[model samples]
Target: MLTRLLACTIAFAAPLAALAQTPPQVSPAVEASAPLEARIGELAQILAGKGDYDAYFAPAFRSQIPKEKFAQINAQIAATAGPMIRIESITPRTPWVADVTIGFRDAIGTVRISVAATEPHQVDGLLFSGLTPRVADMGSVRAAIAALPGRTGFALARLADGAPQMLLADHGDTPLAIGSAFKLVILAELVRAVNAGERRWGDMVTLDGGPLPGGQYMNVPAGTKVTLRELAQKMISISDNSATDILLKHLGRDRVEAMLAVVGIADPKGMTPFPGTLEIFKLKGVPGLADRYLALDPAGRRQFLDGEVARTPIAAISPTLFRDGKPVRIEQLEWFATPTDLIRVMDWLRRNSAAGPGAEVRAILGLNPGIPQPAAAKWKWAGYKGGSEPGVMHMTLLLEGKDGSWYALSSSWNNPAAPVEDVRFAGLVGRAAELAAPQP
Candidate 1:
């Protein structure tokens, strides 16, 4: 659910009638201010439509953001929440800064807009807050899933019962490619190993120069020593590919598979010898490799993967392969897990939370909260992990509400023809989360 779109500027818009109820912080002087109010209103209309507002931006803002960048940001907003419907209210925070409440087709939120007090009145800053969209009821949530551009599967289940109360299942039980989200499974295995005394949290391991290229620790030279716990932190918090591969190498693939079995993952054979980021790149970079590999039966595919891993050196992989090479057929090259299987993983983590390693794992997962949720403070704790590659997107969350209720929301979307819309999909997930626990 964490995406680049969250960083986009969100401004305020409100109906004129609603301005009377606006916070008293705005003096009558500011409300009656002729040109500034009109200009801000004009800015909102320009943003809602496709009009360019480069002339209205402060010199610093214009220099910091290019025209193309603004276009992309506007396009993302339009795709996710539709055009701004109206401004709900505007509260002046300072002579130059004000908070605006804006309504969108699917959501209502507040944004702080700051304008320089100058002749042209250029906008200097914009920030969003409390932008909670209306939660779709169960039926609407299902309809939305069915309306996605590609195949989609989702489940909302309480961790207490481990059963999906609401589900939009288009082959929901079948495992699909889930990119770095596979690291959750590895983290689970690592926690189990630590709990069993097979490995110590502080145990030091020397990097074999096998760390992959997609994340932090990539710059750490070969043979550098670091603690197992620190490596696990990087692996989950940042989806660090290098940290993951190093841990995978340390633990051996068999143990990871065993952990899957131990946790009762619905389909164990569907993912065996879990391919590290490097291995995935090696197969994906070669033309027709994924198709050929996937065409084989499961055993044959596993054998082929093993053979490829044995032959390929981590150093030989071009760092630019994932960025510049053809998009890998994610349906074949990445991790596979059904929504139910992921729910089971969440259940395991919750049931085991009192254990030392369990607590540690949850702590690490909580390190990155993923997308921001409205009324997040109402939850005792929340942990999230998401994964994406061209044509594949997945997100899973474990939350414990203040009322002692536990819930898990796991969803995935796939389209082999194009990249999934990150912002729109994230909004859907946010709606689903809100439905799971409504604000008091």
Candidate 2:
């Protein structure tokens, strides 16, 4: 079931938004033609139904995504979000592309369709993003955020020229525990280094660290050689702890810190030596470690970490050891970021990051496309990265609309007394996405 969900979510390959120097503009007559509308309707019906939809697809698209693959995707969607109920709306963006809103029994979603504008219109590209219909209402978003079980922070911004317009915010400037979402900082730093010619993505690095039990590649031998690009993919895609630590070690703490400083992160001290999953687990596992670590100042904590690293091995600790401990000092040990600060980071990445590294980042983030992204059709491209531990949950998204505008949405939920309810938090974030959707 989980495998099918992942397959359905990550099935779509993002289309190149621009291929030619200037795309031919759609004329008003062509835009208003009944035939084009009928074609879109027919395609949507075929896609929403269970039977083979190959007749509607272009030869190239058919070859790329075969009949069996389409069936699997359909089945996965049904199993995960239920069958499609209706087609709410279809808006043509270009002669070749249209934004579609699809309703499922469980939720509403958007599908972006691009077709070859030839004799027989055929699908050239297809992408799905889950979205809620309430996204356009700021009051709805505010109500959702207010109803969350624990302390919550969120920021939604429209990425237009100059400054971002904040649509909704609740404690947006306050730093909170952001779990593995901090990986974005590492990714940004790596991209910066790559852009500056300090490192190549293909550079092979040996994975020499002790095995961390929390994520993928744990069973692989320590000395296995892999490209920096592969490590970055695993780190962001699966939240692979070993991959993160390896990349961090290769990039060095100083470089990441410098990157943070340049980005003007709010809580620089909280991230100086970002803790690997294993290190965090070890700290949680060792009795009395949390209290002692929290009692110290930043410098003292750094000294404590050095001692702990020297004294302990990851294999000796278990991730579940501190599960029973309530109100742990997660804020002090784990990564922290405010929604505003995170939005700034996303803005920088969207505007300044090079094309190659930016594409890679988006691909990695698009791997786990589970979050509800209400009004998904308005977005031309969407990528997401989220993180969670016992008491911390965080989500961040970078999105581009069909109109050539960009946006960023970030939110965090934290509760020291108990684990934050995952469903509730995700639902709220989804509502927030609805509010951040592009205005018609």
> lDDT of each model, Cα atoms only?
0.65, 0.65
lDDT of 1 by residue, 1-440 (tens): 01111111000010110111122364566642444565567767667654556766777877655566566656766666677889987767666777677778876655566777877777776544334556558567667766887778887776565444443444568687666778878888888888877888889988766435455566667878999888888776666666787898888887887888666578776577577776676676555566777778867766877786557655454445534213456666677888767877877766666677556877777766554334344477767777777677787778777778788788888888776665566656656666676344
Check candidate 2 and list the clashing pairs: 130-373, 131-373, 131-374, 132-374, 135-434, 135-435
Q: Which digits, one per residue and each the tens of the lDDT, describe model 2 over residues 218-268?
A: 557778889988888877766666677778778976787777866658668
> In model 2, which regions exceed 4 Å deviation?
1-136, 160-163, 315-327, 354-359
Clash counts for the predictions, in order: 6, 6
Q: What C-alpha lDDT, on a 0 to 100 scale, does residue 319 get in candidate 2? A: 43
Best by lDDT: 1
Q: What is the TM-score of candidate 1?
A: 0.73
Task: Give the winner by TM-score.
Answer: 1
- TM-score per model over all chains: 0.73, 0.68
